[model samples]
Target chain A: MTIKDIVYIALFVALTAALGLMPPIAFAGGALPPITAQSLGVMLAGSVLGAKRGGYALLLFVALVAMGFPLLSGGRGGFGVLLGTSGGFILAWPICAAVIGHLVHKNANANIWVTGGMIAFGGILVMYTLGIPWMAVVGKLGLDKSLAIMVAYIPGDLVKVVLATVIARGLRRAYPNI
Target chain B: MLDLYTPGTSMLHRMSPGPKMAALAIAATALFLQESLLVTALAVVAILALYRVANIPMKTALAQIRPLMWIFVIFFAVQWYFSGLTLAAYVVLRLAALILLASLVTLTTRASDMIDSMTRALRLFKPIGVNPDKVSLAISLALRFIPVLGRIATEVREAQKTRGLERSIIAVAMPLAIRAIKMADDVSDAIESRGYRS
Candidate 1:
């Protein structure tokens, strides 16, 4: 990796953590697990930074969270969250970004629509695959119940995928190297 | 924002980052292996004792574990219903112990020092053609970037709210992401002009 790569990875990690500091998109007064916008940053990382760098960026973000930085959604952090209901999704984020990047960027012929589709699949499908199971095991909800709760997260993520696609397209157009 | 590491002269604070981290890793895993609440309760007591020895104030200690209180309550209630009270006690105690241990490490060690340890550990991967220096640089960069981007994103969110577009994911997300990329480009250009090559 060059100095440029280092800069990009750090920038994306900061971007993701920054998004976490913003208020949650869904305003439910902190009762339910309302939708957070940080996942948008994860999608943008993969879509804009590509797989390897994007994955590294998220790995850094997660590492900081594990280190007790209040960088997660709602400004929550520390190792306890790894055992919390959200731990699975938190752990899955790096993989989700990598999958999104790999699927969308691997093929030279892949178009905007293809990228959008892959982001949805990778960010939503793959994330929940790891997340729901972990939620069930840690939160002690059965797999079926975890799925039911996770469904609420889909619409927000789909919107994020569209947002990521537009930004990624614009970024690639302006700075093709990304 | 929760800058946890308090300046102190206690043994924990004086200990090298590597050994403290190793002990934390061991204690964290051990809390999981044993299902007995008795063991976990004892472990929590030992951890609190260490905290006292470390000069971490009770207020600071409570702040560290405070956010977890509600989650612990909910999980305990769930465990009580689905499993049993004994299991619930064990689960909560184990989680508390692990979280305290992790927070203890964070409070004692500096972030830069942790990054140094990370770089040192990654140096073992040099034979695989990976650049540990670059990886370490990236790690440090990520740590520095968190506050910068957080400020930018919050500003964007407020700006979007004025236009009543805050609820629309694209309205807030687009500007935030676009500005982040723009910032990245400027930084990349600065790095290039400084002649930093792989």
Candidate 2:
């Protein structure tokens, strides 16, 4: 990787971590739990950085967490997070970003629908595949129960996908080479 | 902005990050592997005692667990409902011990020391075309940029608020992304001009 690539990767890592520091926004008059902006950072990482660098950014983020920085939401970090009930989702982040990045890169002239679809497929479909099963095993909840809990996150996650796509699109227009 | 490392001359503070981290990993695994509540409870007590030994204040140490309090409560209630009280206590207590032990390392170790140890460990991957210096640089850069990016985010939000677009994600996010990308390019140029190489 060039120096620019390294810096870009680190920049996205910080961006993702900083997003965690933003207060979660409650939607639907607080009927649903507040949605975190951190994962939106993941979607942006993939859509903007492309597959390899985007994947590395998330890998670096995870590595920092393993090294005990309280970068995760709510200042949670360390091996405990990697081994927690939400471990599945956290572990899936790098792969999720890579998947989105790869698809977005392939469709260089992607419109809103294409970008949103890629984000949803990678961020939701790929993430849930790993996160749900892990939660079931770790929490001792059955697969059905774990899936049920994850359903609560769907609306919020979809909102993030849309937000990330719009942000990515704007960035692309502003800096086509990015 | 990232002053989690508490200054001290205690044993834990003096201990190197590498061994402390290794011990954390082994101990955390043992905490999960063993199914005995008594063992886990004793581990919890031992971790608390270590905090004292490390000269870390009770409040500072408790701060590490406070953010996760609700998570712990929800987990306990769910586990209790599915299994029993004993199991629930075991799981939560074990989790608490793990978090405490992990936080203790961060609290006692300097960020530079941790990065140095990581660079040393990563040297083993040199045979695979892994550049340890670049990796370590990226890590430190990411660590340094975290607070900067956070400040930038706040600045963008405040700027948007004046235009009555503070609540609009697009307004805040678009400007933030553009600024961050521009900053990255400037940093890359600055470093490159200073005789830095990839």
Candidate 3:
């Protein structure tokens, strides 16, 4: 990879963590992982950077988290956090970004709304695919129970899908070369 | 806190990146495998001693562990209710020891050195078409920019507050993303100017 690739990856890793700094909206009384904005970073990375760099960017962010930076939402990190309830969401970020990026790339010539739908498919559907089950296994709940907890975040995720689709479309329009 | 890599001459600062990383992995595995209070306390003490041998400041060490304390509280409270205080202590100690081990390694190792070592290890995957150098570079850059983006977020949030948009995730996300992409473009130009191509 060239320096440009490295920079793009770094920027998004930082973007993901930066998004985490904003306080999360608690879905309930904190039983489920609070809705954090880093998922927006995942969406933007995919919708903008496409599959390779987009996925690498989030994987890079996960590397830092693994390195013990408190970069996660709520400033949590380290190996221990890997065993926590939110670990599934954190680990799934790269895959989610990659899936989103892959689908968005397939529809690159399509209008923004179609690209937006792809983002939701990858970001929401694909993420929950791995995340909800991992939450069940790691958190030691029934799959049914985990799905029940995960249900709380659907509305917030839709909001992210809309926001990311808009920003991504606008970003590309203004800076076509990117 | 895994902040910027501070240059230092402490033993930790002097240690080789590879062994330190191995130690972190081993320590973490050991912590999880064993569940006794004796093992947990011993492990914690051993890590604290390693910190001293590495000459990390008490403040830096505590800062690394501080944010995690809240989660521990919840873990402790919940575990205490279910399994009694002894088991809870064992669990929390095991958890704390793992965090400290990760932080200690991170603090001691230089970012470039760690990346170089990782790149060397990742070379094993080259036959499968994975570019280790590129992966390591990405990880290095990500670590470098965590603080930069953080400052940008704070600045944007302040600006949003002025416009009464602070409460809006869209307001924060839109500008933050636009600015990040702009920064990425400028960086790409910088790289291109330096004769690097994707």
Candidate 4:
């Protein structure tokens, strides 16, 4: 990789950390509950950086979390987190980013709707495919229970897909070669 | 900019990064695997004592756990609801012990020393196409950028708020992405100017 590639990767990693600082957004009288802004960072990394580099960026972020930086939402990190209930979701970040990046790369020049679809597929579908089952096993809540709990976050995650799609489209327009 | 390391001459501060990291991993795993609540509570007290030994002030130690207060409360509530008070207490105590142990490592080790140890550890993968130097540089750069990007996020949020777009995620996200990309370009150029080839 060139110096530019490294910078891009590092930049996304930092972006992920920055997004963790965002306060959780609560809606629907707390029935739907608060959803974290951190995962939006994963979507943005992939949508902006593309597969390999995006994956690397998230991988590096996870490594830093493992290294004891309180980079995760609510300033949680370390092996304690990786072994916790949401460990699967945390571990799936790199793969989730790569999946979104790969789809975005294929759909270059696509419209907003198409981009949103790809983000939803890769970010939401791919992530929960790994995350839910892991939550079930780690939390010992069973698959059905885990799915039930995690489903509530989908609406919030969809909002992130839309936001990432819009931001990535604007980014492409501003810097065509990026 | 927000480095957790505190310079000192304590035993933990003098310990090498590799062994300290290893000890943390082992201790954390052991804490999780054990089933005794009393042992976990003792471990928490032990970690606090170690913090005192390392001269980390009580306020600083409390600060480390502050951001996680809500998370702990949620976890405790849920666990209590499902498994009763004892199980909940065990879970939270174990978690606190693990987090404190991990933070202790970061508190004592310099960022450069930690990165150097990682680089040295990664050298074993050199034959598998890993470039230890580049990986180390990327890790360090990512660490350095975390606080900088955090400041940027704050600035972008305020900038969007002035335009009456404070509640819009897109408004803040767009500016943040653009600024981050620009910064990346400038950083890469600076690195290249300094004779960095990769």
Assess every candidate by TM-score.
0.88, 0.94, 0.78, 0.87
Please identify which of the two predictions, 1 or 3, would achieve the higher DockQ against the true structure: 1
For candidate 2, the C-alpha RMSD (Å) to the true structure equals: 1.9
**TM-score for predicted model 2 compared with the true structure:** 0.94
**Which candidate has the highest DockQ of all?**
2
Task: Name every residue pair that clashes in candidate 1.
Answer: none
lDDT of 2: 0.87
Per-residue CA lDDT of model 4 for A1-178, tens digit only, reads 8888898999888888878777878776765447888888899889889999999999988987877677887776665577666789999999999999999988897888999999998889989999999876655456886788778899989888888888989999998877
lDDT leader: 2
For model 4, the superposed segments whose C-alpha errors exceed 4 Å read A27-34, A137-145, B144-168
Question: How many angstroms is residue B163 displaced in model 2 relative to the true structure, after the best TM-score fit?
Answer: 3.2
Better of 1 and 4 by lDDT: 4
C-alpha displacement of A177 in model 1, angstroms? 3.0
lDDT of 3 by residue, A29-70 (tens): 876556788798899998888898899888878876765566
Of the candidates numbered 1 and 2, which has the greater DockQ value? 2
Please provide, for model 1 over B1-198, each residue's C-alpha lDDT reduced to its tens digit, 9 standing for 90 to 100: 446567889888888887877777777767666767788899999989988999887787777667667667867877798888988888777777877778888888776677677778778878987677777667666766777777876799899889998777667666776687778778878878988765
Query: Which candidate leads the pack in TM-score?
Result: 2
Q: Alpha carbon lDDT of residue B39, candidate 1?
A: 85
Residue B169 deviation, candidate 2, in Å?
1.5
List the candidate 3 regions with Cα displacement exceeding 4 Å: A1-6, A23-35, A68-70, A73-80, A83-85, A108-121, A128-156, B1-11, B56-61, B77-90, B130-172
Cα lDDT tens digits for candidate 2, A3-92: 999999999899889988878776668554457878887898999999999999998899888787878887777777777778889889
Report the number of clashing residue pairs per model: 0, 0, 1, 0
